[model samples]
Target: MTHATTTDGVRIAYQLQGQGAPLVLLAGQANNHHWWDQVRADFHPARSTLTLDYRGTGDSDKPDAPYSTELFAEDVIAVLDRLGIDRADVYGTSMGGRVAQQLAARHPHRVAALVLGCTSPGGPHGVERSNDVRKALAQPRPEAARQALLELMYTPRWLDSHPGPHHTLGDPGMPAHARRHHLAASNRHDAWELLPDIAAPTLVIHGADDLLNPAANAPLLADRIPGARLELIPQARHAYFEEFRALAGPLVLDFLTTAPSRP
Candidate 1:
């Protein structure tokens, strides 16, 4: 457990685990470093993993102001800088993936490789969520919202077979206002025009059944980024890493460990 101060004086909480080359894990909207708990072991031992709580979530400061993808990217940079890590592999899920896009585009030298999971580039090319899903996400009660989220995030089979032990709501969880701010930040994220600027070896992974971001966005992201590869997990939903860790884990580790081809 450690904290890094962003340029704006916001204290960002992050954790460094295991040993080997640094591999930063960025969580989606409303999620903190603990979101990666389910799959943390996948990268450890072979690679040191850095997990962080984005401002407005977890132990990080919540300023109650408008948030942007670029701002989140800078917070990530602050964590890396404080740790004295000059370069590292990055894996971002959902909104975290959006921030990874900006980081790779705006600060190419800092990223050695990139993995984008269950996320979108935003703009016209990206698929919007259904009204029902949005409404469910906006529920005032955390339990109700979590129920709504489960339907959109996992397949029925996975949920039926493995139930309970679910993550708790509140405190470490995102508050209503913070969730709104994160959503607003996500809504404004548009990296379609900047994809071509990414020079790192990139991998775009998505669940075929993801409703929030949709699977169609994966191909678009792969196409826009030069030499990017796309991988889809069948019958999986938004939280494939959690529901299908056995498969998603190896794929991510292999991509992050593989050497990039010289031009």
Candidate 2:
């Protein structure tokens, strides 16, 4: 366990695993570092991996204010400064992708490569949800919010096979109020116009059946970012990492380890 103080005074909780080049992973919206547990094993132990819980989501301090994607980027910069890491490969999933994009645009020197998963540009047909789904997520009831999350994010097969909805009242023991706030934070995020400025070796991965963020988003991102490659996993859902942890982990490890970094 480690802590880093952002410029805004929020103490971010993080852990470092492995020992080669540093890799910073920004988790999805409403999630903590545990989200990366399954994928961590795929990396070479010689490489360093940094996974952190964003404010209001995990062990970090949750302040009462409107959270934006920029703040999340700042949090990443703070971690880098605190750890004395000058450069790193960055990965973000879902809402975290918004932060990763902002980080590359705003601080290109610190980023060696970028990987975006299950995310979109927030353009037309992106991860924007329907009014009913949005309303359900905002509901104070845990069950309602959990159901909303499952419906908007997961595919039918994933829900049937996983233990998500069965224990929706408090699936991971996180409180209803916290989940609601986290959901709100995810909903408030949008960054469609900033893709062009990301100047790094980039990889965009998405699932074919991501209803929340359509698979079409992968092409849009690749088209905008010069030389960015898009890889789509057929029949996978929004939570593809969880649904196919074994497959997803290795793919990410291969990309991060194989990509050549500029000197």
Candidate 3:
């Protein structure tokens, strides 16, 4: 329910929980802080968590102006500064990972450790999603599109047994232009050259079955980053963090707790 005003005048909304060292959890594209609902508890007792809504997502202000991952990083910094947090560990997935790249590269002193999940370094060097997945994602029908996304997110076995709720895109009230702007920002993210400059202890994790962001990019991200570790969850898809939260969550926690702030 708390808020921070970014330098650009956008109102960024965020929530803080738990106690001990600070750990900011960044959500995927068009998603708010709630994207970490399934895993935040995993970090409890060890690290406090901060989750914020991106400019056009969740409870944050949505302006018609263009957005980029770099701007999103600044928004995060403004919130940290507002709260008087000097440095923290950061974990980001999907679009948020792109923003983390900017944060760590541009403000190395501000990050203690970093974890990027199911994300890619965009630009010409990044591998694009398969045409099949892209076409299914293009389905205009809401119900059909939801099913398609659910399929991409989890294996049939898990979906058949759990049949639980899942989050999609941003708020139902988000304007069309904001959604377009979010997609454009993610599409434009290019941190390949900047990856080497990231000094935070880092881990790049992804799903081997991911079609949205090919698993190949995970190695590329790990290889480019000075000493980033790479992990791929077999049989997991785009939503590996959720589909295999039990596994993915611990792996992240171990790396964060054991790795030195910088090498």
Candidate 4:
């Protein structure tokens, strides 16, 4: 376990794995480094992986103040600085995707390539979960939120084939506090206008069956950004990267490895 101090003086926790060019995995809402566990091994022998738990999630210190995606992007930069990595390919899912885009816009020099998974550029109603999710999370019932999330996160076939009691999304398990923090941070995020300025080569991947954010958002992202490739994984959903790591892993690795270098 390693640590870095963010610009706001928050102690962020992260773990480094593999050995090669650095690749950072920024997890989605209410999730942390553990969310990348299933796919981390696939990047081996090619890219060193840096997975972080943003402040208030995983092993990172939780401050009471409200947080935003911009702050999270800065936290990611600070993590890279602590590891002495000047540039890295970034992979962000959901909330992480927001930070990834913001990072690319604000700190283009630090980012090499970008992989956005199951995410959207937040504007007014960007990727709002169903009202059920809002009520469930607001009720602060961890189990209900988890179950409701699973519905939108995975396709019906994947959920049916999988056994009972799905894997928890968060590292320490999803608690009410984490869910609340996620909702607040998500609401505070807005990165739609900045999409045009992202100079890094980008790959936008989404599950065709994704109910939470819908696969349509992928094309919307690719269409707005210059030279962004959009790939819709068939029969997959939001957490398909975790459920079908075999498929998602190679897709991302290839995207990073084969993308043309930036000028």
Candidate 5:
């Protein structure tokens, strides 16, 4: 475990594992570095992975302020700077993907490659969640909220077969205040206009049955980011990396390891 202090003086926690080229893993809203535990090994042997807790998640400082994607992006940059890493392949899921967009757009040189999974650009162009899911997410109680999240994240068959995975639903242990801030940041995030400015080799992956961030957003991301590749996993949902790690893992590994072809 390691710590990096952001420009705002918030201490962010991170972990470094495996050995090879640096690969940064960013988690979704209200999740921390530990969220990657299940898939962290997928990139081992060929790449060294860095997983960080975004402010307000994991062991990071939970400052009482409105969070934004730009803030999270800066936090990630701080982590890299603290570790003395000049460049790395960056991968983000959901809210983390939103932050990755900001990082690549704002500091393109730091990102050698980019991968976004089950995330949206936000704003009018992005898909909005259904009211039922939204209400469930606002359940106020931790257990209820976790249940709501599981329902929204996994398909029925996957949930039925893997009942134990429910423990992973809210494993980040985010406080209610911090979660509210994260949710606010997510609601306000808008990267549609900024996608074209990303210069790194990029890959966009999404689950075909994703509900939180519809799979339709994948094409928009792939098309907007020049030279970006898109891959859609069938019979998967929002947390495809965990629900279908067997399939999503290899696709991500290949994209991160292989060189991008010139257009």
Candidate 6:
């Protein structure tokens, strides 16, 4: 584990493994470095992967402060600068995808390629989650929410084998205030106007049945971003990156590993 100090004095924690081209894995809202635990091995040896804990998650400082995708993006820049990596391929899921939007739009020179999963450009232009999906995600009790999340994330077939939800599901295990901050930041993320600013080759991939972010948003993103590609995993849900990694992993790996960097 290594720590990088952001300009704001927050100590961002990150883990780097393997060797080859750098690939930064950004976790969803309220999640930490462990977000990539399931699929990290799939990309092993083929690429060097880095995963970081966002503020208020894992080993990073969880101060009582407001958070935004823009700030989260800057924190990633701090980590990259600390490691002297000029540019890297980035894969971001859920809220991390929101931050990735900010990163690639705000710091185009730092990203070689980009992959966004199960997330959307927030605000008025973005599609909102269904009431049923919201109810499933918010069950009053944490345990109930976790249970509901499992159903919302994984298909019944996956649930037959995988009994429990990941610890990093929903707001993760963060303070109530920090969890609120994460949701707020994710809610406010409006990359609709900023989408066209991204210069890196981008892939917008999602689950066909993602009620949380909704698969319908994928086309909007792919259409807005110049030269971006769209891919949908059939019958998958919000957490397809985790539940359908076999398909999602290779698709993302191939795009990032082969896309030409900025000249």
Q: Which candidate is the best by TM-score?
A: 3
Score each candidate by Cα lDDT.
Answer: 0.88, 0.76, 0.90, 0.82, 0.87, 0.88
| Evaluation by TM-score, superior candidate among 5 and 6 | 6
Return the clash pairs for model 2, or none: 19-46, 19-47, 20-46, 20-47, 20-48
Best by lDDT: 3
Among all windows of 10 consecutive residues in model 3, the one with the lowest summed lDDT is: 164-173
lDDT of each residue in 162-256, candidate 6, tens digit only: 87547447434688888889889999899999999999999999999988788888998999999999999999998898889889999998888
| Candidate 2 local distance difference test against the native | 0.76
Off by over 4 Å in 5: 139-145, 165-168, 261-263
Per-residue alpha-carbon lDDT of candidate 2 for residues 194-218, written as tens digits (9 for 90 to 100): 7787888899998887776667788
lDDT of 4 by residue, 1-263 (tens): 67999877899999998889999999887777877776787888799889998888888888777778888899998999998899999999988888898999999999899999888888774656667656754556777777777777776677788864443355555556656777687777777888889999999998888777767778888887799998888888888787778888888989898999995
What local lDDT does model 2 show for residue 140? 97
Error of 5 at 89 (Å): 0.4
Q: Report each candidate's C-alpha RMSD, comma-separated, in the order given.
A: 2.0, 3.3, 1.2, 2.3, 2.1, 1.3
Q: Model 5, 241: alpha-carbon shift in Å?
A: 0.9
The segments of candidate 2 whose C-alpha lies over 4 angstroms from its true place after superposition are 123-127, 130-141, 144-148, 151-185
Q: What TM-score number comes out for model 4?
A: 0.90
Q: At residue 251, what lDDT does model 5 achieve?
A: 87
TM-score for each model:
0.93, 0.84, 0.97, 0.90, 0.93, 0.96
> What count of clashes does model 6 give?
0
Candidate 3 steric clashes: 0
Candidate 6 overall Cα lDDT vs. reference? 0.88
- Model 6 scores a TM of 0.96
Error of 1 at 222 (Å): 0.3
Error of 6 at 130 (Å): 0.9
